[model samples]
Target: MCFVLYAGTSMPIPQKEWRNDVPGLSVEALTERESPIAVHFSKPEVRYIGSTSGCGCDFPHVMFQNGDWPWFDDGEHDPEQEASDRYNREALVNLLQATGEQTVELYGVWDGDFMTPPAVREEIALTVIVDPSFRFREQGLYVVRVA
Candidate 1:
């Protein structure tokens, strides 16, 4: 899914610069998954899709771009597990800012064969795992949202 930012919006939530601290797959490769990104909505009638495994977490066993970073082994190993958290977190933050969501609570995350209904249609609830401290560290909040 593509996140389009509105014009004249505030800078995205102050997230630390992507440190490339975790090693993982390239961004392009992950986005090609069958069930990449999932958007959720609160109204249920509203039109939105929410879930996990989008943006940089679009692929399995791989993070953003397939590259070497500090957090992971960074030596020819799958970056999905270690990098997905951060990648998806950053993507969610960017999405909220782009859509003008001052404080978005990520509720859920889903990948191929993992999300409910098998395929996300539009307008639904979501629960996501986000780092509450706004830091790239592993400790964070387990957010939930109606999207």
Candidate 2:
């Protein structure tokens, strides 16, 4: 399963609540079958979608393509993960600032068997808080945090 994370307005609304308000937008609460990222957050605001769905396009592909997720083959000390961690933290901080929300809810879109061959499964974990102070923490295997 491929997981995509998004920083959304901190409104805890049920998935069905979007049926009439969002039109074509598909929203469902995280379930047992949810992706690892979704399960990590365990928030009612989180939603899951098919990998092939256009929802995956919500995030800018250029962000990831621009070395956001990088790898080094030299076997020497690799900083790619650190770079990615910083990117994630900055991205979320910008999101919170843009939304002017004290706390922004993190959303995970899991695209499981619904994606094609070119798309490989991915997992990401992020927790953010803006009240009192600003902080972003990655909760999955790839742990990265900023406060």
Candidate 3:
């Protein structure tokens, strides 16, 4: 869905509340289902599309990419598993900033099927993730509304 953004207002996704909303996906399912990113590939972080609120096309707005999954290694080999690094908002911002990336794309994956969504400006993603004002509603998720 396409939604226009106004006054730079954006909001972060609340991790805890989102988790409760998805009763079917267990913690393990979420963790195991995380999309893989090639480390040496050297590009902006790609995350799973969990859920989106408001408009999906809004610029500089935060989107629900994934749920709260514990970071761990199952000792199994998926090849890309070791290269795919899922950084928190802070680290992710720094990582993308260093690369000078201008945008990020959110994609959906269900039962091994994949769908590519529109791209959000890299600036907006970084801005909301680090903003402190929206931290009140950020239960592990980072976001903001610029109105």
Best by lDDT: 2
lDDT of 1: 0.30
Is 1 or 3 the stronger prediction by lDDT? 1
Estimate the overall C-alpha local distance difference test score of candidate 2.
Answer: 0.35
List TM-score per model, in order.
0.27, 0.32, 0.26
Give the poorly placed runs of model 1, Cα more than 4 Å off: 1-79, 103-147
- Assess the local accuracy of residue 123 in candidate 1 as a C-alpha lDDT between 0 and 100: 24
TM-score of 3: 0.26
lDDT of 3: 0.28
User: Which model, 1 or 3, shows the larger TM-score?
Assistant: 1
lDDT of each: 0.30, 0.35, 0.28
Model 1 lDDT per residue over 1-147, tens place: 332111111232332223354432211211334322232222111112222422323322222223321244446655564465556555544455444443333222323421222121222123233442232211111223324
Model 2 TM-score is: 0.32
What lDDT tens digits, residue by residue, belong to model 3 across residues 18-76?
24343211111123433332111123333322222222121123333464223344666
Which window of 10 residues has the lowest lDDT sum in candidate 3? 5-14
- Among all windows of 10 consecutive residues in model 1, the one with the lowest summed lDDT is 3-12
Ranking by TM-score: 2, 1, 3
**Candidate 2 per-residue lDDT over residues 1-147, each given as its tens digit:** 345443333454334322433323244455564434433342335444211223433322211234233433465543664443444445344433544434444443334421212222233233432231222221112221222
